[model samples]
Target: MSFLLGHFNYLIVVFLMMGGLWITFSSRNYIKRMIGLALFQTSVGLFYISLGKVAGGTAAIVLDKTSKAGEALNAHLSPDYVARAGVDGVVYSNPLPHVLILTAIVVGVATLAVGLAIAVRVREAYGTVEAGEIAELDRTEAGPRA
Candidate 1:
């Protein structure tokens, strides 16, 4: 259908999100879970970036009217058109979502790094990265808690 074709990026985002969640929950290895979490974060970033996009739109940069480029842009339009359309008849994509996503990406990378470091420490202490094995070791070390 046209609707499905038009929103293909959304479909991919949903697929990535579900797959990442499944990998994170179904895998017992800490490394696999971290990778899944990263994937999910990436999907979220992509979704926000997509949401900020506009068809036939330019970047939200302000051009000085006295600049050559701005003069050239204005030359293509009539005063009436400029008054009717605003901003020299140029359509700009929203930058807020993109900016927020950029921050989210940086935070995501830091969180992932911290998570991986913790996993590394867990591996060093337990000699294995499997969650079940770590739990078993903990239970054995407890030695029948009353």
Candidate 2:
């Protein structure tokens, strides 16, 4: 279908996001979980960038205007000129998503750093990084679970 062909990137993004989620959920190693989390974050960034992109578009930037002889005297008429001059009749990609994703990337990296630090502390304390083994140890410490 034309729709599917036109939006193939979206499908890829979905697949990537799903794969990352699967990895995060199925893996028992804390390091592997962090890697999966990073993959998920990357996929999210890709999705945002794709959403911001246009098939045939330019960057969104307004142009400056110079006043003509008659327009100089009639300053009130400048609004019309300003509006027309600002538009270049070119389709442009949305920039808000890109900006938002940039911030998300920064936050994601900070979160990853903190997560890794926690994992390291967990390793030092438990002598193992596997989540299953950690859980068993915890269960033993607290006695049998109901």
Candidate 3:
């Protein structure tokens, strides 16, 4: 029960990845192919973001104004407070994954842009942008048989 819910995002990420891959590989339409690429790329971004999240931890940025110079890190919690606290108090999402996701997001955007540009070119060259049409045209251009 708890385990299933904990790993739910992984399932979503897997589904998204497969769906995107299928769209990218199986489609014939130029725009459709680009759409699939976008989905696939976004799923990657989702994967990274999912990894970076910490349950109750604060954001990763350091304080510029509030901290006194060279203040030692220390804290004391009463027994009741310690006993009542869930894992949230100790859990911190990995900052590295979040940073990686940020880069991946930028890469995804670039990929989407390139894919769209290619699709436009394909449409201009083929007259019809449908996948089957493009393949048929390509086949016909290659040669004809009786």
Better of 1 and 3 by TM-score: 1
Compared with the true structure, all predictions reach lDDT values of 0.81, 0.76, 0.68
Question: Positional deviation of 123 in candidate 3, in angstroms?
Answer: 1.4
State residue 36's C-alpha deviation in candidate 3, in Å: 1.3
TM-score of each: 0.78, 0.74, 0.71
Candidate No. with top lDDT: 1
Question: Model 2, 96: alpha-carbon shift in Å?
Answer: 0.6
Error of 1 at 98 (Å): 0.6
lDDT of 3 by residue, 37-100 (tens): 7888788888877877754443565433224421221133343442353233332346797787
lDDT of 1 by residue, 36-85 (tens): 99999899888888888865455779766567866676676666665555
Root-mean-square deviation of each candidate, in angstroms? 4.5, 8.6, 6.5
Model 2 local distance difference test score: 0.76
Model 2, 46-67: lDDT tens digits are 9988888854444565322243
lDDT of model 1 at position 98: 83
